[model samples]
Target: MNRESGRYKGKRIIQGGRTQVRTVLYMAMMSAMQSNPIFKATYQRLLEAGKPKKVAIIACVRKMVVILNSMLRDGTMWDENMAKN
Candidate 1:
C-alpha cells in the first residue's frame, strides 16, 4: 500500500490534511494506529522486519484507507481484526 501520493502533497505526518475530508482520513489513520490491533501488529511487524518507521506508518495509513473504502463501498461495518492474518 502506498500512502505517499500526490493527493497528500505537502502534508507532513504531524501536519495532516487541509479539507475536512482529508482531516477525517488523517484522523482515521491515526485512530487505526492507536486502537486497531491488526494495524498495531502490522506496524510492529513491519518495523521489526526492518522497514523504516515512517514507511511503516505510511503503509498503515494506506491499508486503513483501502479497508475503509471497501467497507463504505460494500455497506458493511468495520471489523477491526479482519486483517490480523
Candidate 2:
C-alpha cells in the first residue's frame, strides 16, 4: 500500500471482489464522507449552500478523488481546512 497523503493508493474495496460495483462505489463514498474530515466538511458546505444532500454527497466523492490524485502526485497528507479562502 502506497501511503501518499495518508491515503492508501491502489486501494480496493472488495464487494465479494466481484459484485454490485455501483452500489459498492456509492457506499464507499458515503463511508468516506462519514470518516474523512475533508469530505465531511465539503459535504456540509455543499448542503449549507442549498445543494441537495445527494448531489452534495456525490460532489464530495468527486472532490475526494480529485484531492487524492493531487496529494498522491505531490506527496502530501489530506488537509482539513486548506481552501477556506
Candidate 3:
C-alpha cells in the first residue's frame, strides 16, 4: 500500500521490474485474449464475474506470465490440455 498525505492507498503492483518485459507480456496478453481459447475464456470469465476491464486484463497478464514460466521451466510445448490441469 502507498501512503501519501495521510491517506492510505490500495496495494499496487511494484514498479521495479523490467518495464520492457512487462510491456511485451501485456501486449502478448492482449493478442492472446483474442486468438487463444484458453486466454479468451479466462478473460471472459473474469469479466462475467464482475471484475473491471483493466483488472481482468491484468489478471490475464499474471496468468500468461505463470503459464510462460512453467512452460520454460519444464521445456514443454504449448498444450491446451496441459493448461487445463
Candidate 4:
C-alpha cells in the first residue's frame, strides 16, 4: 500500500507469489530475450522507451506465460508469426 506523505512512499511488487515459479520465469525470460526474436524485439522496444531492464524482462515473462497458456489451451504449435499477431 502507498503511504502518502511518508518517507517510505514508493511503488513495490506484492510479494505473494511462488518464488520457484518466479525464478524459473526469470531464467526463461533471460534466455528468451537473447534467443527469441519476438521477446528480443519487445525488450529492445521497452529499453528504447526508457523502462527499467528488470521491468522489461518481467513484461516479456508475462507475455510468454500468456502465450504458453493459450497454446496449451488450443493445442496449437508455437509459431513466430502467430505470436507476432
TM-score of every model versus the real structure: 0.62, 0.56, 0.77, 0.86
Candidate 3 local lDDT, 2-21, one digit each (tens) = 44455656655547778898
**Which residue pairs in candidate 2 collide?**
none
On residues 8-57, what C-alpha lDDT tens digit does candidate 2 reach at each position?
46532323543576566668889987887767878898999998777787
Q: Arrange candidates, best lDDT first.
A: 4, 3, 1, 2
Off by more than 4 A, model 4? 1-9
Winner of 2 and 3 under TM-score: 3
Off by over 4 Å in 1: 1-27
Task: Provide the lDDT at 55 for model 2.
Answer: 74
Better of 1 and 3 by TM-score: 3
Runs in model 2 deviating more than 4 A are 1-23, 76-85
- State which candidate has the highest TM-score: 4
lDDT of 1 by residue, 23-72 (tens): 66656767777977888888899999998787787788778878878889
Best candidate according to lDDT? 4
Write the number of the candidate with greater TM-score, choosing between 1 and 4: 4
Order the numbered candidates by TM-score, best leading: 4, 3, 1, 2
Model 1 TM-score is 0.62
Between prediction 2 and prediction 3, the one with superior lDDT is 3
